[model samples]
Target: MDFEQGSINISDDVLKEIAFRSFIEVLAPDEKDVKKLKKSIEIERTPDDNVIVYVRTVAPYGQSLVEFGKKIMKNISENIQRMTELQVSAVNVTITDVVEKIETTEEEE
Candidate 1:
């Protein structure tokens, strides 16, 4: 018996954007994080054409970076696979920085 799995080709830039969005999804929803945050991903293609994604992002100060990384990695990996059908070997999240979110005060507005 023979089986065929059609291949889906996705561009690196698109993957990076998807990863960024997914990373943002797991971030602490301080309006600051949503407004002033950024993230990047590097995808290393393997011998089998599968990819390992390395994500770099910031976390809210005093937040558990380990838990943040885990959530970001899991969410990004799942979104990538579900949307693109690409095989992800692993998602490694690196917390590049932790910044405090100043509480939004109406006086500042």
Candidate 2:
């Protein structure tokens, strides 16, 4: 897009940050675990100027990964498009690991 002044260009890092923040918002992972998710997001620009997003992360063992992935994709796509006005061709989510949700049991005093 162009204005009277000049054209606005959005950087890949900004795009990635938008997607990353969206992912974090939807996933709601533990604060400490957020670092683990930071490096897994990537943004690609297609020849046609469209965007493709790749996300890899771990999910809780009992959750439905397919549904979770779909949720992630939807959030990421919507966020990038809404924020940057970039056409998102796809948002691919890969579940890299599954960790069991730990349960804490209280001891009777």
Candidate 3:
């Protein structure tokens, strides 16, 4: 979707892309694993020009709703400055859910 005509236009694809990029940048993965982690996140635009980003993140043993929300806000702010010509009032992130970590062991060949 296009958020260029004075209204926030977004689709699932766009939200996923934004969430993936934002998460990767803020979380700083050891490697680029967009496919593995992207599906666990969701993002939406609020009516007041704020962005709502939700994620089921891993690494610190538990999810940090506050930290994640801050990251998303920063990302959205930066993006608005770099990509858009409109004035962004603010970015509000809401962590609707959390995911539990499960141990994964890789088998040696």
What TM-score do all the candidates reach, one by one? 0.71, 0.86, 0.47
Candidate closer to the true structure by TM-score (higher is better), 1 or 2? 2
For each candidate, what is the lDDT? 0.70, 0.82, 0.54
Residue-level lDDT of model 2, residues 17-87, one tens digit each, is 99989998877876766666667888999997899999877777888889989999999999999998989
User: Candidate 2: where are CA atoms >4 Å away?
Assistant: 102-109
Top-lDDT structure, candidate number:
2
lDDT at 105, model 1: 30
Kindly list the per-residue Cα lDDT of model 1 for residues 1-109, writing each as its tens digit. Answer: 1237664567777887787688767764566644334435677878877778886665677878788778888998998889887788999876666668523233222
Off by over 4 Å in 3: 1-10, 45-50, 59-69, 80-109
User: What tens digits encode model 3's per-residue C-alpha lDDT throughout 40-90?
Assistant: 665555666455556555433465667766776788557654554434455
Per-prediction tally of clashes = 0, 0, 0
- TM-score of decoy 1: 0.71
**Which scores higher on lDDT, 2 or 3?**
2
